[model samples]
Target: DESIDIPYFGELNGIQLVNPIWVKAVPYNVKVVGANNNVVTHLRLWSTEPSKKQLVQDEKYLKMVSKISESLYPDDSTDEGKILRLQQQYLFSSAGIQDAIREHKALGRDIKDLPKYYTFQINDTHPTLIIPELMRILMDEEYMGYDEAWSIVTQVAAYTNHTILAEALEKWNIELFKRLLPRIYQIVEEMDRRFRLFLKGKNLSQDKINHMALIGSHDVRMAHICIYGSFSVNGVAALHTNILKEIELNDFYQIYPEKFNNKTNGVTHRRWLMHINPELVNILDKTVKGNWRKDLSAIKELENFKDDESIQKEIKNMKLAKKRQLIDVIYKDTGVKLDENAIFDIQIKRLHEYKRQSLNIFHVIYLYLRLKKDANFRKTFHPQNFIFGAKAAPSYIMAKYIIEIINRAAQIINNDPETKDLLKVVFVQNYNVTYAEYLFPAADLSEQISTASKEASGTGNMKFMVNGAITIGTMDGANVEIVEYAGIENEIIFGLSAEEVTQAYKANSYNPRKIFDNDKRIQDVFKFIKSLDKDEHYFDFVFNNLLNVDYFFVLADFDAYVEAQSRANKLYQDEKTWWRMSIMNIANAGFFSSDRTIKQYNEEIWHLDTIKL
Candidate 1:
């Protein structure tokens, strides 16, 4: 198995050294057992088993293993680690470009014709080094001139930005960039120079030109490189695209207004709807006309079924079935049993402060406090199960702290005799793609509570919509579009709009501390967080974060969020209306199909004709 014959390409002198290459599949979850782990020992044994002529090829691999063991780390948070990541990017991109050229050569096509055959859309700035790498291949390897290489490279590449978070924007220090990639850096430097001259020719201000430059004061902005090298630059959603034009990438937008565009993010309904909710798919297949699978717009026909009692009841039954499946999983994983009758209010995404998992937890705490304070409200209140699933990035201290508090709150509330059955709390561990298939459909309410203007676009919101879960969300990201599709009365929309949030920041008029002091309900929530018995140390930071730095405006939107929840609860009491709203969500979600998105991309951006199977 290790001596499997494969196509070989030698880097040195372009001659094959080995007739066959030894390839091995390594498990990611291999046990660490001192010096001889399973992977290491297995590889070591395979290499030492001798060759046909009894030549020892083992030493070469042993040396490689030793070097890898010494250089590689468990924690990729250091300068060396950062450099390693850059090295990986360069290696992957360079190799991929080389392969593409090899394929072009096999077809007997001129290298300049590469643009007609291939267009690489760089999703985010991760693979942006490929632009310069391709240029280097053309100019250096193929002996093409700089102008010719630049033209071909520009035609073959496009970029899509997914986030406006400053930290998420990729930038490499000039020293590290030049040291690691001397040739690519040279090409980038020339590109930056040409861009600056082009801006000067347009009579643009030097300040604005500097802001839009590929290379900044001490670093090379990867996004700027992407924008400069690519034929087009796009954002993931409409609002996100507008914000990119007006705010984040404003300088670039001004210079190349024609290059900027919007492609609102979409999810594959085949995965989110057809596969995940097969029962609902079966019902739709029976009731809805035409092939809705191929033509998602046909899902709009389900709007007529909204008023039908039988269909509404069937939808409710489907949700209950999903809840039963999820409850079994929760119990198996976390040993926490959830009530089937309780409202399954779910918030699941990556743990980030802006996404506002903390706000959800705070509202849960407020409800707990209310139950403890008022007997009549406790008796009358709807039984609710607040479910959460998230994973914090290892380096993000605040996100990890947020997870800890959520778990801490869950532990306290779920154990309390008074609140255990009345209000359950569960935070599912290691939430992933496999889990989402089960999670989205079972939800009574979907939480899309990211701060207004902060979220790029949430496909999870769309997935939930297709699965018939009503969103209680801010008018941000695709949620604005979702509200429009579902009707404003259906999806709970409560928050400052993007313009209002931006204006508040411009005026420097917003203060979280004032809200904390002024609002009793918010004050009580903060007080409870401070007074929590478990994780007392973390509570101080959480308290400080709110009073001193509520960057996501959790306290600012707290009242509106709570009022929305109250409204949701009241509406849930009217089962007929709630199911009708859920049906509306399912009907409107047809527009969110990735088939439509890809069709748009093919027509507008990629300009490629579809090939029928």
Candidate 2:
């Protein structure tokens, strides 16, 4: 504890000071229980600790150091917050790298052999700094040459690209980076110089080389550094990987085609299935006896029982019970009573324009309008409850606006007697892992309707799929693979294909205004949204975004989404068919298990030898 001394940035006498900041390594024992036994793994959490002398004399230093471990992903709305975020990233990377090297040296292994024994998987752009940090240790600390350290660093690290959004790929301003981390910035600058020389040797055009450069005019591209420094680069889903190669990171792919690969995302059935939905687990136990918990592939046997009436009845009853559980929670939390018998259509993810929470709510408005005006339509329609759970980032204005609109819409629809019985909207407050445990099992229709090629791969989609929720989604992210596994007919798939969405963006041919003008239903929904816009401008942002600059194609996909919703409602009316489809979804979800994902990673990327306990 407090064993690592890191050079930290501060200001004294109106001048920058690079002083030693002591850090503590807090250890946690994580027990992984197996069938016969359990293994203990140590997780080291790094925390900043001021020296005893500094603690008594320098309150500013104490405050500065304490901020590092106080919270995660702090509000980066101010300059202070932005610097703290970068500091947090570097703290984690530097401390972890130092610890790893120390452990290897303690084991009497040569520093050059680090790659043979260990590998670092950079989850996303957040940890890309690990590349430079590792290089710094190898070259500066171990006194290795530039070529030797670069070779070892590349061999030891791999990157996983999690987003197609350019903003998600982090870029730090060069001045701020150098100020916060002077030595690390020097290493990064050197890395950039060598990489530029390497790129030029390949006979690349100046424009292309500049585009791929790690350091741009004003900032350092973290993702570009990750790609250049890592041995392998992967995407989380099949479509996501293809997008990375053919479009997003095409230049990098052109240079190193062998580096690109796909490892589709997955969820643990132990948690999503067995742990959450015990009733469904019991039904599976009775119908198909196998070690499905240990081996999710055994769940595929449930396909044979899809047509069994007794099995279907058990599944239906289990789903109804889960819905009732969710209804109670909704009533307790929001004072909103829901019809447990109504189709439980749920969309719960981070609130974002690209994720299309607006599209989902717009459909709700359309349905509300239809229920009020058309008696004949109301007579034929089935009752449904729309549930949404999400939290927007503090700095994201539009996302916060979407949240406000959803809550306001929930207030209006849930209070009105005319549509209250047939249609109910509930936005669960403070949604998190606990809320998801309740939502996933209760969902009858899972909404995975992100815009095509926008979502990388949604683990929530996998969670819902395994819990027997039929998906109503666009062909994006893991929804593509989910449809392949669960059978396309079972899912109500809609909207533009990823290729079409990409092409429309490239050609600038698609217009949300055109779609808004062409369709009366979309017009009716927008009118409803406009009606809600008061002095607060709660719905004004939504109206302008959807009509004027719908980058995620919410308006473009509106008609297809509604059609898919109708198809889902019609299928819900047919109980036997719906249950059979639900069973099939559960049966096929075995493919998307975390077991398979990890196995693929170990085989293709990490290649670490297993040690038996």
Candidate 3:
């Protein structure tokens, strides 16, 4: 671990800081090792550590200090959890700003020229406190005027909005915020008052002004602070950015049009492609004959050999090898032997209602029922191993229920004599980064099947595409950009468009009960869910949520998703066509590289000069 001295402030002019103790920044460098076991690069990950003296203090203080650097997003169901989460945010943000300023001044750069020498990227609402924190430091410590400090803060900071979900955009209770950090609260209150006056001067209505207020009636809206404070506000994908402008944050976008932009999220091709699937990398190396690793656009040259029988055979073999490796891992981990020959359809992400883990399982139940009842389907159906990997948040009861249901469904489906061979379900426990190394490369079908307009740009979709998995997804988030890059024919696009979903929500026209009653397939799936537990209707909460609320339109998109799955199943039967599409997906995936995403951020927003090591 590399240690850096972090100037911690317990009090600045009689104001208590977030964590009232001096701490050390002991960050370890995460090595990105290549397939050949050589360290390709290093990603320095920063973390907090209390001083040795503080470690020997009273138990209560040590516990409080430790909570600051503990696991992220702790259960905020109680007041204590909320305070800890807020404290964690301030702890990191305050330390980071202090470190940056110290480093800048140590280099003999003037405080007024801080914006020219450095820029801060506020990744999301979690770091929104940085704006006010910076303002406080400049005004109090550097003795700058409020206007000058605000000017410097605006120029140095930028924000990225990663979600459209209201719950995900953080807000702190005003009382709690004020009680914890009095000085920071004071600065934020003044900033809010100033911004409100600025908005009123623009002739905006009071309702609009209130809607865009940083400090609301009872709470401090973090996103509002970010939008008003930062010079640039970007979304993670093309569709996501458009949604923010038109629907989610339209008020802010209308006022600050020039600040809004799009930078579709991406995954590292070197780690996702080269390290994860070295066999595929070797094949591409032989066929493309270019430095595809350095300039991923060179990977598109593989399109020339897409139709070649020899290349197709090689790709098929590589995929099968990966599947076999995954099968062994699943057997070791879960004691469920996956069929290497079966289509490896994977949906792995955070367990959330919008991401629709329930929707995926509903389709699995439908297929299981079809195999039992339909003779033609039993004869003609291609075998499939439906794999799921996810971890629900501790406090999210519904998400946790979905995980239980997926596992319960897996248990029933895998043990069934009638469908065990043809259809197998495997929910890998404790899904994390290590398991993802196996899951991404082995996938035959990547399920980006969230309800329309829900997901921010999903890097998982890009990871699956780069590793040659055909996507069966809704036209949402980065899936839209994936289709544009990989071609529509190469992917299985389904469900409501983002605009249609938005219109449905706006019109309040969606009725899940009607769709459930109309569709016999959906009814059969629910029947299976009901039968999973005889003593009680354990999953009735899920059923009720779907019928009563259906916030994500799972029932509305059910028929379309099933049809798309059928199409993918049939397409998988044709070896030549499947391999060709897989090749095409890999070739076109160069556009979704992290290298491309970073380049765009530097060119458009940051404009930081490149320096040689």
Quick one: best TM-score, which candidate? 2
Full ranking by lDDT:
3, 2, 1
lDDT per residue (tens digit) for residues 111-165 in model 2: 9899998899999988888999888887777888899999999999999999999
CA lDDT, every model vs. true structure: 0.81, 0.87, 0.88
Q: Model 2 — TM-score against the truth?
A: 0.96
Could you estimate the TM-score for every candidate? Answer: 0.88, 0.96, 0.94
Q: Stretches of candidate 2 above 4 Å error?
A: 10-36, 52-57, 536-538
| Candidate 1 collision pairs | none
lDDT of each residue in 1-613, candidate 1, tens digit only:
3231111122222221333222221112233342222332221211122224323357764442233223322234677666655654554455556666777888999888888888788888877898988887787778888899999999999999999888778888898877666657778998899989998999988998888889999999999989988888998888899999999889888878999998888998778888899878977887789679877889988999999999999999999999999999999999999999888999999899999998899899999989988999887788999999998766778887788778878888999998788898889988999998889989989999999999999899999999999999998899988988889988998988888888988898888999988889888877776666655565676788888878789999999999998888878889999999999999899889888888887787888866543
Q: Looking at candidate 3, what is the lDDT of residue 49?
A: 62
Global fold similarity of model 1 (TM-score):
0.88
Sort by TM-score, best first: what order? 2, 3, 1
